[model samples]
Target: MIQKLKDKGINVIAIEGNHDRLFDFEDLSWLDHLKRENLLILLRPSVRDGKIFFDEWDGERGGMIKMGNLRFYGIGYQGVNNSEYVERLGELLDPSFENVVIVHSAIGGSSMGLMPGFSKIEEFIPLSKKCEYVAAGHAHEKKIYEIEGTKIFIPGAPEYWDLSENGEKGFFIYDTEDKTYTFIESKKRKKIERKIMLQNGSEGEFSAAFSMAVDENPVEKDSIYSITIEVPYGVFCNVNLAGVEQKLEELGALKGRVVTKWIGQDSNLPDSSDDLDIERQIISADPSLGNYAPEISKAIDKLKDLHRSGDTDQSSMVIDDLLDQIIGEDGI
Candidate 1:
């Protein structure tokens, strides 16, 4: 693609993310080819001591590019630098000329979580009014938001990744003369977000819920989907994650690709098990607890207390012991 673009007298500037380096070392022939063609490839530095600093030559860390009537300043990862890169880039912008800022990171709730007190999004508000538009990547979902007469375009990814099944995979074409931006959709596969609600019930009920979810959101063989299971508290008592994975694998063979399977706690459930039997309660009270250790530790403690109080009739004391050992070793 770089060769084709360069052949047509178009200057192609490529920015490499963290994931891009892995493939570069594995199969670097294409990169060599692009380098030979004088393509501007911006390589990101490795993270050291919890910080990833960018150099000026690293696509100007905060620099400017003049393309026809538009000036583009590329901002690598705003969340990594806490929008310092964006702020620095803003300083370099020529306020007189029409400009566009291109970013390789996703803004808003998905990538960097919620930027509450920082007002990082607000920083771009003034810049948007100064520039013609802003183009960004990293997010797989295609979105465009106009704030203060400035258009923030998340062109999304040209390829499918993660839970972007519902996202539009495309590129953006910004006409410098007219100052208009248009989306050009890619020929990549489509994705879908399928959620399943499992009420407080037995293992069979959970399975039925999964089945029903798949049935309702029937995906094509080539389509990818993210199946989010909202299991109520105490409902997944007998549910097996491995079994669920196997079932999903089987379903994948029948219906498209099941890229990710996430299990979330129902919001209606109690926050803690103070009133109910903690041993019977699910270890995760919220969807965010999937990999959170503190919540897992609390659940382990509850189970241990249940075992100590001789409430092992329906629950497994052995499992409680194992969990305690694991949590103790990990210091969670």
Candidate 2:
């Protein structure tokens, strides 16, 4: 894709995200390989003795890129944890050119689900006063926030990364001189979520509610869809979830999931039983969790069992493992 963009005389300047950093083989990453091939200008700042420093393009340090009169400074996933490095952003830019700072971090007024390794918007304050614009990632919601003279632009994920994510998927083109931005919607797949609340989990009740939901908001062709069925805990067995999802597949959806939400259930449910509401709630709380919700839900079940057994030590171990799994080995 970068090659295609380059072929048309368009330069793709990029910064490595948390996911991109994992694609490393030997010592060089896929991003490094692309930069070496001149397909994309990958900008990554250097950290020496806990201090951040940017190198010139000719030096191949990838901290800065100059296109015409605009200067773009990038601090990729590596800078997310270091407050000192991020605070020094203004000092790293040249005053002569129009400055733009880009980083892959959760930059907003508040903590985004209290997720690990995300810098808050306040950390960019010093740089915001000096830089003309700020482009941030790691938060999949599209928004713009201004601090001082700088306008922070988060274009959001180009595609729906989670069922919780809704609205238009797009990119932004900013006019550096005019301080204006024009959003261009990407030709991305749509994500549709529908809920069917059942008074009784009988097949008739399921059919009526499901058909009504489909009639009101007909599923789009080749779109990702999720139909959540809410039923009482005891009656969930009556609803054929597999058949429900299969009907969605037959209706021309690219991918479909039939998630169950058991309502009116006591917290003392058996451990052997599935508490799908926990998984749904986890994903709803932080959509970036994606498919990890199942594993997390299983861990929660284990913790619950341990608690019932009065094994505090075992419960602590299970919690530690869950935290490590979610936040990586590095506990924040």
Candidate 3:
């Protein structure tokens, strides 16, 4: 696909994230192909410890680089010098060329997973102040706007890495001659979420309501879904969540998670821990054991716990008792 773009006189420049080098950065045959396909992958040329983060990535680092007529002052993830790496980059940058800055760190504030911590946002402010335009990577969510008088841009991931994140995936196209940028949303497999409030509905009514909700916000073929229905405790035992998911699969969803939230406690069951016995906990922990008789389930629990905790001397006796309870001293 990239070669097709190159055939049409287009070029690509990109930054690498932690995910690119998570394992050991040793098996990077893909990087070589990217370089050959009219693509420029940027990185910090050297580290403070004089060690290479990636073995085959030979690209420009923290400095100025002019591609065609556009000039940029940039830094790679490996080239960051201090704890306040963003601030240090701002201080070192001349900002005289085109007044644009690029880096491998996150810029749109704190995010979960591979993105930088919240405090790093403060360090990022200095770079924002030093340049008129700043673009960054490492965030999985795309964001673009002015923060404290500086134009900030984050192009997220080109592809959806998590099927659970319900967001549009895409990249950015910056027109250096006009000093303008535009987002290009990619058409890829997406994940959609449907949350329904089961405030008032009978066991018979639930199936119809679920079907209507699905029809209103239809699931696309090859797309993933998570349909969550919040139901009252009284209706919990009657509703078949698994059946609902199977129905959604037949409609189009490639994968799905059908979940129900039970509100309030059922008054019929005992709520106090003190009222429960050892036999109850085993059944509660592993619900499959509930099908067996109480005495057998309790005996099985004792044997399993003893075996797990390495108390084998007593387990043998418990095993013998369990076998006798089952066999009734008969040969069969």
Candidate 4:
């Protein structure tokens, strides 16, 4: 894609993220290959004797690139919380032109609570004061924050890394003249979520509710889905969430997740501290795994029966298949 862009006479400038570095070797990075090939321009700053200096590349001097009235500055992953780096970068900024600082760092006040060890947006107050726009990366959610006259632009990830990352996944195109940025949404894979709450704990009730939810909607092909079933603790053992996932897969879902939530704890149940009985202890140990108690119990019963019959070959096959079915190819 970089080659294609280069062919079109378009300049591709990129900053390194944490994953782009080969940490084992000093001053080495995965992006070195691209830089060597001249497919793209690398503009990340370098530190020598505690002093920051930009790598001169593509006829551009310093860490600054000039195109018309806009100046682009790139900084890679250098622990944003590091006061030294942030302070030095502020010293490099030229307030004469429309400046855009593209840095891969977490930038937000409340984000510090959600992403510990990340630099607070306040840390970049100096840089934000000098630049017109601070384009940030590393976080997977799209957000914009204005500090003084500068705006922080986070375009978010181009694709959903997991079900939890639910939002418009894409990049941004900033208009230098207008001082406005427009989000360009990517044609990434869609994520769908379906949740069901059950009042009755019976197997019949569970199956009927699941079937109705599935039948009511036409599952999109090649789309990811999350199916959440909330049931009373007593009835959780009787319901089969795995079956619901299987049905969704059969209906052309690229992938499916079946999350079983056991609600309303039973007073008669054993305490989680009781390790004497493995089956009972498992249910009491973690509420998240409690929904699997019935399936685990059934599997255990079948294995015991096979053990008594001395069917070693059949037992091995059953165990292997069961493990594969439950764990999947990726092992959870």
Candidate 5:
């Protein structure tokens, strides 16, 4: 695909996503294989404000390169917002050359057409003054907003990585000569969603219903088809999930996830995490946590104690206790 993109004269400056551990190649020598082919030109900055850094940064992984008359500066993913960095953006940005800021973080702002699980609009407003456009990623929904005369364009991930990312899939084509960009929709893979209820049905009956739904959906040769089914516990227990998925494959489904929900068990049961609403309420009630809610959530998830709690050596402890018991019984 990189070669194809290059064939069409589309230069791609890629940054690692959250799923990618892009820091192993500090020397940048491993990328030589791709660089030799002239397929990709990475914008991995090594320094900012005269201080050298390792990986692509959040605020300033500063590097300037001219591509087709347009200068570009990139701040790759540091995996955190680091909102306060916006204040020093003016100092860090080089205004001498007209350039575009390529960041791989979601510049959260403007709730208009916001997708599920997306970062809300935040402190990237100051970036426009420093650069022509802030081309960002990480939000799996395409959203472009003109904030303070700067185009905050986030060309979301095309191939829906998660079920929530059921939005249209595409990438942006930046025409450097014209100083304009356009979204090109790629229809290689289509996403299909279905919600079905098969109340009081046998395994074969449920399978027939599922097969009917799949046939009715009309998924392409290689596409994603996700179905959410509401059924009784007995029906689910009898249903062959793998068999259904295999049937879907035979019908030309490339990949999919089947979500089952119990209806007759308890209709009033809470959805998702039961404590999520309570957690949000707590955050709303507390002014301090509310102000820095995002940060607090990140910190809470990073607690080492919570990570280590499940790592107890129960087998070793039991062996040691058994050894003590054997030592005492030897006298008998």
Candidate 6:
């Protein structure tokens, strides 16, 4: 694909998603290879504050490239909203010449999910309107929209396919001279959907349901597939999750790749149990806070012990001492 784009005399930029850093180690390792070969420009996400750092690329995001009467302004995935960086991009845009903005990360999916909020695009759109078109990737579905008169294009994933059955996998080509965009969709790929229900039944019945679900949705040996199962809670209580996983593997229904998730009510709950509600509240809260609350509570308990052991008094004398310190009435 890189060679094909190059043959068309178009500059190709490759952007990395968070997932690419994981299972796709070879691509991450080949960053320098692309740079050396001059085949494509590679942009990677920066780590900062538990999210991709957008500010690190403020002064060093993209460079200017001249293509015929068009001036392509490249922006990395970072610093899309910084005022100074946006102003810098604005300065690069010339009214006399057509402009194209090439970006790796657009405002969707991983970029949107990982970022704190959705305000960067607002800051970028105004400056981007000065350009003829904006080409972006990272979104797994192709999309084109006009924001503030700027044509925003997301070509979607090139070869990476989505597990969702409805996902569109494709690429885009923009003719700089004619200001036209073309989307090329991949060949039709086979998709399979499997649903299994394991109600109050014997072990053999449950096993047969699982087997039939797999058989009914056999995946093409070469096609990508996804499986979603809705199992009532406690169905797996006596049954081994690992054993079920092995059974699915034996069925060979996932074409070597399988992603399974469970969704259902906690049918295993007792009618008089209070544990579920309290546990649910803690589980639903912010994960970071949930992790720290127990430690904070433990510290408070220790402080209470100190006070109860006569290390500190909670009466008029203590209040008087505190007031004296506040007024600087006590000696330092």
User: What TM-score, over all chains together, does every model reach?
Assistant: 0.58, 0.72, 0.59, 0.70, 0.64, 0.60
Those runs of model 3 whose alpha carbons end farther than 4 Å from true positions after fitting are 26-29, 36-39, 49-64, 73-84, 107-119, 158-160, 190-193, 199-206, 215-219, 232-246, 261-332
Ranking by TM-score: 2, 4, 5, 6, 3, 1
Candidate 4, residues 20-70, lDDT tens digits: the string is 775467557767778778777777666678678755445532466777777
Q: Which residue pairs clash within candidate 2?
A: none
Off by over 4 Å in 6: 4-29, 41-62, 79-84, 108-119, 161-166, 176-179, 187-189, 201-203, 233-332
Clashes of each: 1, 0, 0, 0, 4, 1
The deviation in Å at residue 143 for candidate 6 is 3.0
lDDT of model 2, residue 120: 65
For all candidates in order, the CA lDDT equals 0.54, 0.69, 0.56, 0.67, 0.56, 0.51
Off by over 4 Å in 1: 21-33, 40-62, 110-119, 192-220, 225-232, 237-332
lDDT of 1 at 238: 54
Q: What's model 4's lDDT at 248?
A: 82
Tell me the lDDT of model 4 at 315: 56
Residue 195, candidate 5: alpha-carbon lDDT: 74
User: Candidate 5: worst 10 consecutive residues by lDDT?
Assistant: 304-313
Candidate 3's C-alpha lDDT? 0.56
Deviation in angstroms for 261 in model 2?
3.6
C-alpha RMSD by candidate, in order: 10.8, 9.0, 13.4, 12.5, 11.1, 14.0
4-79: candidate 3 lDDT, tens digit per residue:
7778876555544444443255334344457655465444334457432322233533345555444565555432
Off by over 4 Å in 5: 4-11, 19-21, 28-32, 48-62, 67-69, 81-89, 108-120, 174-180, 201-205, 218-220, 231-238, 262-332
Winning candidate number (lDDT): 2
| Local accuracy of candidate 1 as per-residue lDDT tens digits, 136-174 | 655556887676777778876677554324557788898
Given candidate 3, what's the lDDT at residue 305? 39
